[model samples]
Target: MRTTMKLDGADLLDLARGAAFLGTGGGGDPYVGRLMVQQCLDDGLTVEVIDPLDVPDDALVIPTAMMGAPTVLVEKIPSGEEAIASLRALEAHFGRRAFATMPIEIGGINSTIPLVVGARLGLPIVDADGMGRAFPELQMETFGVYGISGSPLCVTNEYGDSALIHGRDNKMMEWLARGAAIRMGGCAYIAEYGMSGADMKRTSIRNTLTLAMRIGRCLREAKDRHENPFDALLRLLPDTPYSYGRIIFKGKIVDMRRETRAGFSVGRARIEGLEGWDGLMEIEIQNENLIARLDGQVRAIVPDLICIMDSETAEPITTEQLRFGQRVTVLSVAVPAIMRSPEALDVFGPKGFGLTEPFTPIESIV
Candidate 1:
């Protein structure tokens, strides 16, 4: 079993970049998180990533990330210590310090923000995350699906404002925290879904931190070797739980509608096919890409990844960054077997988002 890994130089950046890809058009941009981690390194900080199995069963592990509209995040950048403050608030409420910090979801900034917390606090970042991909709401995560409570969640914004929220359920927690975020200038950092190491082993997606890094490494190295980056991605994913990676569509954004509403960025995008591809593909969003349809037939849906990237550079575009006339390729990957369970689907699948479409795997639908 893997014990630990040290992130420095390109490792941190690759992890951030790959997270941007896995984010599936949510989790906000990794660019800011990458810069923060790089700054930590510049200040002679070390980011130690520990395997979840190494965590003691009794230890408290808190997953930390920024929560709110990704569109709002672009304008309201974090002050870097907001998450740490959130964690401290949790610690104060629990009357015990945290054993480690981890990402609640695998997305651009959320994927790397915990590393920033870890380096600043001198704690290890667990190589695990609550969700394999980003989701719109806090309740839509494996942590909640598998019975981890999302409160006593601590929400904090820059300028030292903070609130510790408790809820009867994860959905209630999301509602309360999201309202807090919107009131706090539209974005806030959070530390929530606190659980024991045992809870992590049972519910969290393991090794995703390293997987995100490896994904970035593959794309970067492939480019250096003058190979197709997308081909490198397809080759790399099958070996992991998120498998069956394929190009679902090639197109240019013909039209897009996006807005920051109710503390979430909600919208849809239409991509007209190019490169011998025909028809149009539509991707609906609520912070993250939820369902993608090609010519009105579902090719991918929630719980599976529906990623849009720069066709030439393979750079993942968040919902906020999406625009008209950009050449993009849609890559769909199957989620881990755990995320597809009927119980898990109830919280994060199509029905979870109020859609009538039955949950279907990318391989089956495509």
Candidate 2:
């Protein structure tokens, strides 16, 4: 059965927190998503979350997501109408009405994007997502494992211009779509991976929205109880183990050296670890962190979730926000088994990020 609820400002905050926990350190800013969703909610849009079984077997289900660098996405905000335009274009391309719209990932800016589009289209939003955790590429989805392609993608810019692209494969789809996003000034709304509800249920992580809500609730509850929020998260997701690490350092942000070449946020953060640690730790970023080195020793790297969160509240910090001397706790979570397969490595391993050496499972390192 389908369900509907209206989210106020407080509800949106809870949703953002929950989505961030599910993001697993790769989705873009949840703050921007929060603002967009809040705007829709203020306009009195009712968010309808529908179960996967509620959709018919033959129903057309299209998953939508933001394409391009997260830093650029925040700067070049959606033209408000582009989200709806992307959906409308897909509807036009398929020559049929879409039964539902949904998120490709269940967190960050994506968690609320589908809702905005759904509110505008008067359509129901699916309660699931292709990837239970956030991934870096369009093709790195469970849908891909089930042989779904992201081609026939429709990208719409803020100026009402739309382009329908056909890639020989999902890689081509990402390439062509990324190029177009650069031309569109670094961000464009895209609707891709059209499939049936049956196919979606088989490929997607079921009840991911519910999972996000649960994660958010746990974080809030942990804070109230003065318990470890990270521990609470681990308890919530027993399938994924959380890496044990300390509040290695904390300091004010002094400088930010960044570049947006190759469509990735490539930068080095220089933070002077405070208290017992009295030196600099060099942090790296490429969409997400690939390495963290302290005083010339490699501390953490890929396949591990090495993320920087606020020292007090434990909120995640994206690559773009890694500034010098920032008061932050560098935390690492053991990678989930889902991302450890050779095939999965071939798609998103250290080599995929241009690292020649093979990835060492995070558990082996810390």
Candidate 3:
């Protein structure tokens, strides 16, 4: 089915909140993304979302995304043309006529990026994404798990520079993409991993886009009803357990350290906890929080959701968007069962982040 909607500022804010929730504490900041999409809406652009099933079985679907450091993506706003350039480059490289475009990940800015690309390219946005929750590496996609190749991937810098990256494997594609992104000043526009709807059915996480919308809807309703939004979200995903933790840290951000290294938002935060707990807590982030330490001793890490939410309102905060002096809550929710598999560990475990010991799921730790 094809549907068109007029997404205004309120819609964008709600969608951003919902996208953050579905992001599972990983998709980059939704703030900039909401602003960009709102700009498109202001330009009288109507974003159309199409069900993947609406496309022909053999329909060629290309996923478009922003690659590099999320921190840079905010300062260096996309020129819009680069998103199209990446899409066009992929079309030319494949030597096949293009089909539809889809969001690669469901995060803040990326949630609506494909809509910008689709509006510009005159393509429809696929009502789904590859990963229901964001991961650090491009190869961590369920699309890759189902045997899809990352390249020949198309990338474009805001300066009109464009290139095609080919590699022996997905890992190589991820490495080269990150390197290129760093060279492009910590962020690059990417249109990659073209595949069919049938393949998507096999490889992609189903209904993630719809889920994002629902997640967004839930938050909006929760807020309007003056109910506990976070609790409502926990109830929505019955399959995922809540790993509870105190508001160990709540204070002004004293310091923030971030770098776009190895194609990830690697950073650390120093926050002083208030109320009962006092002192500083250190958070280590790479796309997502992998470790939380209190005065140099480990507190919470992977396998549990080491979530940072707006302390006042309980909205989720992505690693890249974190700033100093922002009051936030650090909650450790249990990891979903799907992420506990040995394969999942290899992709996002403690060892994956170069921690010395193997991962002990956050559920076990908490």
Using TM-score, give the best candidate's number: 1
Model 3 ranges with Cα > 4 A deviation = 1-9, 24-26, 239-255, 275-281, 293-300, 333-340
Clashing pairs in 3: 18-216, 30-108, 243-334, 253-325
Candidate 2 has what TM-score? 0.86
Candidates in order have lDDT scores of 0.91, 0.72, 0.73
TM-score of each: 0.98, 0.86, 0.85
Question: For all the candidates, what are their Cα RMSDs to the real structure?
Answer: 1.0, 3.2, 3.3
lDDT of 1 by residue, 210-299 (tens): 999999999899999999999999999889989788999999999999988999899999999999999999999999999998889998
Q: Flag regions of model 1 displaced more than 4 Å.
A: none
Which 10-residue window in model 1 sums to the lowest lDDT?
A: 1-10
lDDT tens string, model 2, 82-121? Answer: 8678777888888998999989986578887887788777
How do the residues 1-366 of candidate 3 rate in per-residue lDDT, one tens digit apiece?
A: 555444556667777886775564566668777777777778877776777767777988999888877766768888577878998888888788667888877766778788788776778787777665666778877677657898989889989887799979988998888788888888888998899878876666555566666667776788789997766766776532332333345665789888777667787888887757677898888777777777776667664456677867877888777888898777655544555667766766687678775665544553
* Higher-ranked by TM-score: 2 or 3: 2
